[model samples]
Target: MRNFLTAIFSKDKSPFVNAKAATSWCKRLQEIDMQSQHLKIHAAVTAFVSEERPTTLDSLSALLLIDDAAQPSYEAVCYQYIANPRMSKEIESRLWKQITSFAVDMAGVYQLFVQSETESGKKAEFALLMPKVLARSLHYLSIQAKWHYFRFEKVPSKLWTLSHQLYRLSEIEGCDSNPFPLYTSHAQEVTSCADEYIQMLMLGSLSNNNLSVRQIDWVDQWLNQWSKLIQMSRKFQEGRYHLCVNLQAPEGVQKIQAESEGEPFRYWGLHDLMHELEETLRRLENGATPRDLGMGKECPAPLAVELLKHLDIFWLMSIRNSVVQRSERKKVAKIADIISGLDSIIGHVRFDNDKNVRKASADGRGQVDYDEIMDMRLYGFVSTRTKEKPPPNKVVENKQKDWHVWNIENESVGGYGAVVHLSENEWVRPGLLVANRLGRQENWHLGVIRRLNRLGDDEVYVGIQSLALSPIAVSLYMEKEERKEQISLAEDSTLGVADLPNIRTALYLPHQIEGKNVNTLILHSADYGTDKIYRVQARERVFMVRLGSVIEKGVDWVWVTVFVISQE
Candidate 1:
């Protein structure tokens, strides 16, 4: 009946699972055999072997033997069979009786460890499972080959034994599969199943807070291998693609199983494995342990930084064979932006001097550049461009008419016919012509702030280089919510408006009053033939301003000006 029950419950639960179910099923059978304690005990023994139940010396002492003398018999049966070289079906069955009794006697051990605060109890619990683990392992290996010294019988010891082995491997070996079939599908799968079962058992045991020696041994052996098995399984499956694609597909179950076993440890490659192993060993020897960090909290900023590190690995493995989704791509792009912003904040440090930027504009990758930022304390006026009206709607005005407009030139008879102003409407359709400013052409003679000071209650004194009208606007990026603060800076005063023209650049001049700090200088312009100069200051402030004109053939010159202000 026990054999029949074992066969029914011990089948593969899934492709990725192994047969560790027999252990739990046998325990359930014990409850059903209430009338026959011997039967219950026999069932326990069978369950123990199949489930790799621990067979420690202390565990056998607590079994409810028919008589006190039978207790010694139980111990003798367990230790002798486990340590004995001889084997027979009858002898194995008798051995199963003692082993199961021992497991049942040791039940609730995990609960004791979980609940008890005493270190001695915990250590004792850990130590108790060693013998059972050794015996079970031997039984499992023997049954795995479907033989017991050239004889075969209904031995379910293989299942629990596999779980125990898997748990141990995971704990010791980083649990990654190591190009061995047993490590991946066979052994690892059993380990996974056993882990689930063991966790359930441990939970139950913890509630009791008192487990017999056998149970303690069982829990320890099972826990030891559980994590490693999981790691091994994942690594093996992940790297399987590389093996299959690069080498060849595994032919049969045995071969596939064998390959899965050792593939994970090998997946890291020899050099990486060596380094990782060395590091791990160093930690172990030094008694230093890795911190147990929670997943989300432990992750780095700019998720892309983490992803980028594994891009090469994913590409080469071709493991998943799936394209990244558009949403995922967008997320990655956002992460990339965050990463770049962080890099900028930290101030970029380059390993080698960039020579490309020095060579040509097209080659700007490697270059060392610096910009000095100063807080020029100034309080100047701010203004906006006047909005233009719709074109004249009268049809009579559109008709062709004899028109003679005078070419008027108001020239300063002596001090150079320099500064000129056109009506805003006329400036709208402005043309580019070579006009002289100082010693340079109007297009090339970019403006710069010499000084800006409050002239009167409604006007601000300003000095600029360009001989044309200066047009300017504040060009600082402020927090989205800080617009109120920015507007309040005008203090309800009628701020001065400037028609600063060709104002490609503006600098906040340092105040002669030594202690006053100059704050802001704004520049305004339409797209000129100039390159935009993006600037980042020490105070995490950033601004983009047009510097001068570009002499390219297809590029059009744009009109721009500058405005100045200060927070003093």
Candidate 2:
């Protein structure tokens, strides 16, 4: 009598009455845009999966159709947030909550199907559903992991524990190696539960704390193709294999030990993955185009090589131990001023006539009657009469407003770990180049944001890596005929004033003395060209130099090694 009541209740609790109803719902969802569809689908799916009774096959059919329809919306949401990490907190929070809830709901629905099939004593149905269940569960779990990493937040332990448990369940069911369609968009592309698990492990092994959001996205995309090369095993191998994960550890992949002490662990031998990466690097170094090497056209060979090399070192080498010792100290540091972009940094460091430009009155008109257009232009405001855009390397005006105050929680030789309560308009992320000075200090130092963690709605913790101690601003001119003509005019002038063309503003890092042969120059990204020679004007000295390989690059600046051609 109890079983009969349970059956009746379960049948009534199913989300869809029949398969036709589910099909019609999916068809209707297709008519709407992806952004709107996600909200509706999420709401309905959440309600359906929240039922108390066991999920039925009819509901499973609806769930599968819903999952298929939700893929595009899911991808759209992930791309939106990952591509624009600095979006408004309200929108970001909403998207994060929705996407996270959707992933959890989908994973739970699939887990229910697995449980229901197993308990029904239908071996054939269980066998058919096992691979799909594991694949979908891991897929959604990977999405959750990526969103967490993009925000630089710690992924919950339950996520990893459940991921491991799912893969283990697949292995026990003898379907871990079976192939299934992972996505509706790419129905022909089949993958196994093992491959999905390997991809998760690879993602976990990345040094996400050090990589930019875009870099993390690239690694995630590339792993879709690269994870197939990795092989997993139950037995521990020697030097060729090192990475492993304990199924019961509730953590990510780590270095394997010779003996596991009878714990359930899976080992992944990265020999093949490393070999492929090394070969790709060699091909790239041999002048093979990125497109020819199967990388997209937008991917430069150098960038591809850099990413591959990073992955190679991360996978093959043992875990790195930090050598720099940090000290905890409580102190207030006025971020005296913060500046990003080569133009902004140069503007702050250099003396320019723009600072002397006349100010605008209450009506937004220049006070000075003479040279009104020139004054407005110098003030870095768009003029209706001129309609001229600022030069690419022009210095920005009125930078004092970019300052922030922080509490330095720790100090080290390399950088500082500071926390700040940021205003709505202010934003910071990893890979941002910043110039900071201590409170009441006149000297400014250059650094890059290496890590960032949100402590709360308005509070953020940042790890900065100092680049130089006393960088001086300088003018760099292309060594072309126009520049040579300007130099001749200066030499021939009685007043020693030459009307030179607008040259690039670059930061000369005096502390980055790379021996007597090489120096470092931080120049605007647009101003950097391969093998370009430049005449650099310092305070009292002038020299000609040729740019070498790029040491590092950001959205607006490039740190390139320079070789001295001559000194005047």
Candidate 3:
């Protein structure tokens, strides 16, 4: 009450008083009562003494100018706490929440501006509002996006300037905040949906081998949901940041209008979304793990399909432009053909370097060579669209040999080599191995040894194991196994397939993935391929282990453990 009186006597109403002047007052108060922390409380109570609430008439006359320059002081306070441990822990905690609150509110303002201008058809207002709203929007998004990227991916940089700018554009174009919570909640939704779609794609990719009809339906559903969610997210961003304000106006307030001025904002909004979606797809394919960005391990297939779809659209658009420009039809046709061919090739070709080769001396006394052959198979047509029912399981013939001698020159014998040619369609399963000879060459023995040793040059060994031990549960495990060693786990019979270690990894599932109450797990191992003793099963929900990864010579194997599903 005494402090309240002090505020009533004081002159300023601004939240922040000069710290130097306040410090002396604080010191004096501390001497009065160490337990008393009423400075701010008193300040709040007396804040209204000198400040009068705006009257209804006055409010009507005043412009609601969102002061973008008036950055919330909460951010500075939080930064202070983050940079200094000497500050009171209580102060830090309070500041963190305040900062987050300020950020959300600030973003809301920009969103409001973007939405208002776009809907109003005030092109001039939108043009004028664009730089300011976008600037602030980018600022806020960069901060949040960086936090996520850092927490999840451990990316050092906190700012993706380009992405921030694009996000601003997206927001102005149109993004909704109704469905998900503002911060991580919204982020999680986008990532989780993306992940689900990816999973569907993966299942579809694997379906040609042995997946069931029900499994295919699940994939299709995922794809549909994934496309819709992405579309929604894209719409939100585009709608929020795209404002083309006019320069000439009576009140100097420009309004936003469509490029053509005939159509509504939705077209432009969708266009912006498409641009961002394509960019995101490109990033995922290139394996660029941006900071705080959580893209779930959904199959790459859907992404590929989406990208191809856009590519086709872009191609048609480009062709239209070319025709208008009177550009050479033949050149345009060739470009389109190339794009179509690339789309088909990427759709069907999946390359994996998972096999290793080992050879010994003529007398099997010393290590002669060890190589790993990365596998790549070509399919006639592989759709990115999810299928409702998985194709019937079939044993696709793998018409390739375990080892092919390209060139062999023995220490004591003549050089002789021949290429192994594929004569039939190969049924390549999840764990199948297949190899073809490059061609015949002189010094066949030496060439074979060299090729085998070369596998060591580009080998990344990941181990997978699953076993049925009981009727209830199947255990699973995954671990990074870098060195070669003889590792073993008992196969439980009663539990059915207990676990499948590194199975998700084998299927290229993302780390820290969860689905339908199924927990993915990981284990360490020292083996790979047909040589590794393990089984694969799907039915009763089982524990999946995705290991905490540590980088090794890119060629290390992972260990995993799994046990049967158990009601007990």
- Best candidate per lDDT, number? 2
Worst 10 residues of 2 by lDDT: 317-326
Give lDDT tens digits, candidate 3, residues 1-568. 9999998989653332333333344444434432233323233323422243322211211111212112223334444544454657687556544544445444544555555555666545456335434444544543443232211222122233332333435444443221321222133433222222222222222222222222333334334333333332222232343222121211111123334232222211124334554565567556654221333333344544443343323322322222122212111110000101211211211111111012233585632111111101011232232122232223243333233222222221211212111121121122221122223211111111011110121221111111111111122232333111113233345443344344422321212213321222222223333223333222221222223323110112232222223311
Residue pairs in clash, model 2: none
Q: Which residue segments of model 1 deviate by more than 4 Å? A: 1-40, 43-223, 226-253, 257-568
Q: lDDT for every model? A: 0.28, 0.69, 0.29
TM per candidate comes to 0.17, 0.59, 0.22
Regions of model 3 farther than 4 Å from truth: 1-69, 72-75, 84-93, 153-568
How many steric overlaps are in each model, in order?
A: 50, 0, 126
How does candidate 1 fare on TM-score?
Answer: 0.17
Return the TM-score for candidate 2, rounded to 2 decimals.
Answer: 0.59
Top TM-score prediction, candidate number: 2
Q: What TM-score does structure 3 among the candidates reach?
A: 0.22
> Residue 549 deviation, candidate 1, in Å?
57
